[model samples]
Every structure is written in C-alpha cells, then in structure tokens.
Target: MRLGSREVGYPHLLAAALLVAMLVGVGVGAGTSSSTYGAFNAAWDGGSGIRGVASDAGAETQVVYNTTEYETVDPAGTVAFVISPERGYTDAEAARIESFVRAGGTVVVADDFRPHGNDLLARLGASARIDRTPLRDDRHQYRAGALPVATRVAADPLTRNVTRLTLNHPATVTANESTVLVRSSNFSYLDRDDDGELDDAETLQSYPVVTAERLGAGDVVVVSDPSVFINAMLDRPDNRAFAAALAADRQTVVLDFSHAEERPPLQVALRALRGSAGLQLLFGGLVVGAVALVARRGRLS
Candidate 1:
C-alpha cells in the first residue's frame, strides 16, 4: 500500500505552486506602488541595521536630493531634506544651497569624516577631524557594546527633544562657539582606526559627535555618527525621538539622494524577485512529493 516518493509528490507540488503564485502577486503589488521608495525606503523600514524615526512621522515624508540624474520635490505639505555623505561641494551646488537657506530653508548635514562630506562641513563654518584614536567610555556604552561619545550640546531647537544621544563608530567635529548637541562623557575618547575595536590605552581626547552652528540667515546641524539615522539604530527611543524633534517644526524636508551613487534598479529588483522564486520552487517540490505518495496509496488500495 506504500507509494513511491515521486508518485506521492505531485499534488503537494501543485499546492505549493498555487501558494507561491499568490504570494508573488502580493509582493509585486506592494513593490510597484508609490509607497515603495526603494533602498532608501528599505533603510527607513528598519533594514539598514539602523531604525528610522521619521517612518511613523507621516505618510508624506520623503527623501530628496540634487543629483544630475534625479531631482524629486513634493508640492504637498511635507518635509523635504537633503542627505550628503560627500566631503566637498561643487561651487554651483553650494550657491544653490546657500541661497535656499538664506530664504529660510533648513538643511541637516550628516557625515562620518569621509572626504565626500568635507565641503558641507566647510560651508557650515566648522572643521572635521578624522579621529585616528579610539574613544572609550564607561558611562555611555549601549547594551550592545561601548561606543565613542562626542561633545555635549547646549540647549537648541534642533536638539530640543534629544537629552542624550549615542554615536557608533563616529568622527569628531570642532568649532568655536558651536552648540554641542550630544557629547561623550569624559571616560569616552575617539577610536581613530575605525576598526570598531577600541582600547583604553590608545584613547584620544573626547570631542563633539553632534553640533549645531548658526549660519547667515539659516542654521546648520552636523552629526558625526551616521549610524544613528540608519534603520536598525533609529528605532532606539532616544534616536527616534531626536529625529522627530529635529523635523517636527519644519514644513519642508529634503533627503539628498546625490550621495547614493549609481546602481542598477533591475539588479536590485532581480534580487528581490529571486527570494519569491525560491519560495515558489520549494513549495512546488513539497506538493509534488506529497501528491505522488497519495496516488501510490490509492493505487495499492
């Protein structure tokens, strides 16, 4: 009365195929909608090992940029902000931003001491130092592990919701009369090698991790740790609340996609599609095996 493996597997395989088809249909629908903002949206959806605070802020929140290829702007009431990881700025772009801010635009600059982020720092009237030394802190270490803390901030609108902040593998910023938003305790110092490994004996001086300075007619906020804004890290109450507080009052927010560089959309899409395909194949194989077994049993009976 026993059925061979192949004979039992067919029906099970057919069921699996049907299930996979249903799932794929749902996935495709979700992926093609305006709601899907691609990789940046994925990063905000808690994918980039950092959590995003603005995900729940509103439905209209979007990422903006000034790259030669794409410039996205929303006419509705929403926040539009630029994100740049570059160290230098082109003369034309600088003038455009300066003019925008002079007209009461708000720009949040996030960088990690990379050369790409330098020009933005200079424009903000601050200098950045790539810490070659490791920072150690006994007081400010996260549950995951210890991280280098930077300068503390004075009271300001940008940091109003942020009482304490953490920066993982961060660079340091120094400026005269700069309002320190969050700082590493005296126990913490910069880890310059940036190997994510810190040593007490090799500690450098404690410095600012996030700071804000007043520029001509607008304001500039600088962050040394980009990890705070990533999807995984942004979920932390402190980080999320801080981001919400930073953008709470702003009417328009721009997320600069210029720093994203160039990558093929089809390649990304194919990768996503592959996951669905694998599931379909697995389901089909299981169904076929089950059907074959059932058929063999019927024949024996």
Candidate 2:
C-alpha cells in the first residue's frame, strides 16, 4: 500500500526525535564525566580574567570560579581551585581549600603580595607583602612609560607557554623554600600604592611574582598578581606560551568556576568533552535533525 505524505514523513520525524534523545543522553553522560568539565572565573576588576584565560587555554579539564554560586559546585576531585581573589575567599572557604590541597590535591592561587604575608600565600607556604614603592628599570617600561614592570616567564612550564600576562598595578612577590618560576628584574621594585612614583628610599628589591611549593602529596602555585593571565593580556606571545606549558601534562585542571559572575555548567561540560564520542553523537544528531526538517518541508509545497 502506498503511504500518504504525512505517514511517510512521520518516520523521519520519529527518527529525528530518537536521534535527539540519543544525542542528549550521550551528552548528559559525557558531561557528567571528569574529562568533560571546565570551570573558570573572572574577577570584577579584570585581574582574574587574565589569569583564568591563560589557565583555561592550557587546561585539559578546567573550571573557572568568580562568584559565590560556584562555592557549592561539587569539585570532581579532591582539589578546590581558586584562580583569583577578585571575588575574595572567606576564612572558611580558604580552610576548605587548604584541606583539599593537603589531601593530595593541587591548589593554584595567583595573586599579588609577599611570600608569607598574604593569607593565601601563607596557605601555599609563601608570604605576600605589598611594596608600596615604585620600581626603577631601564629594561622594561609600562605603556605609561613607568619603569620596572612585573613580568612572567618564557622558559618555565607553568608560564613558558603563556603568550601574554596581565599585571594590574601589581606588587612584587617573594617566596621562601619554594620554586620561583617568574621574577621581576633587579631594577624593578614594588610600587605598592601604585601612585606612579618610585621612592628608592622606600623600595623593596626585586621580588617573586609567581612561586610553587610542595605540600604533602599535592602542590600549590602562587602568582603575585592575578592579571598575568587575563584574556586581554593572553594574546601576548609570552603569556600564551606560559599558559600552554602550565596546562601541558595535567590530566585534570580546575579553573575555580565558582569565582566568575556567570556559571554555566553545560558550557564547562562541552568544552571538557571536546574529544568524546558523545559529543560526536550530539553533533551527528543535530545534523540529522536539520536534514530531517529540511526534507520534511521540501515536499510540503
């Protein structure tokens, strides 16, 4: 018996629906996996954004956190990551992060300060004291012709692949018994208040901006300022190289998605699920749906 047009089209519609369901199922399953989730965040002042972008570029699995909503986001593993302090971390949250690090999980805290003074610095076995004096240098200069600018590394894995880095009126950082991956030049000194004036009498010598420490079975990396990896600055060659290196061998990278103003778990999941078969299926379903709709309407006129 010859089937009517509506009846003939019903199979295509059913096929399309089934394809969509299958795709969604695959996507949901893939999204739930550890390899398919990326979390990150940007601070209100744009410091965290730089750092977050650098980290995201190099991470296999990353989460960005810049808002309070992410505080409740369940970390896939033992690590609780915070990229920038633009959103600020409470004492309790810091304690939790510390616990996560101690439990053989990595915590990367990037901010400006001395090696041991800053609260996060202390947690990472470093201190952070702002150098309220201007830095003097003939080698590097800011856009405003300021001297002794803070800089990132080109040879280190954490920063070697980072092509660009942002530095908000940053202060040089210092660390003890930790690996200093990046440093300011000798001519550079801290200008803590950022008044565009340097005082040799009040200057603190070249300090560490980024450092790494080993804690128990895990490690903590601290950056003096969060601006070294924002999206705006990431286009720079040095920052991009540094970011790539940092993300190179890591199996799971977290971005502290809780820190961003917008938290989209699905977006994180899709990015993380880049190479998954489920993603392939999802795309395939989308193509199939489009074709089916087109075919259905083609014969309508």
TM-score of 2: 0.55
Q: Highest lDDT among the candidates is held by which one?
A: 1
TM-score of each: 0.62, 0.55
Clashes of each: 70, 75
Candidate 2 C-alpha lDDT tens digits along 1-301: 2255444567777898999999998766544323212222232333334334444554444454333323443333323445444455566656666655666666667544323236655544444333333344445544642423545453555565443343544555456677777776555655555555656554534556667777766667766555455655544436555555555555455566454444445666565466488877888899999999988787883
Error of 1 at 229 (Å): 0.5
Measured by TM-score, the strongest candidate is 1
lDDT of 1: 0.54
Task: State the C-alpha lDDT per candidate.
Answer: 0.54, 0.52
Model 2 has how many clashing residue pairs? 75
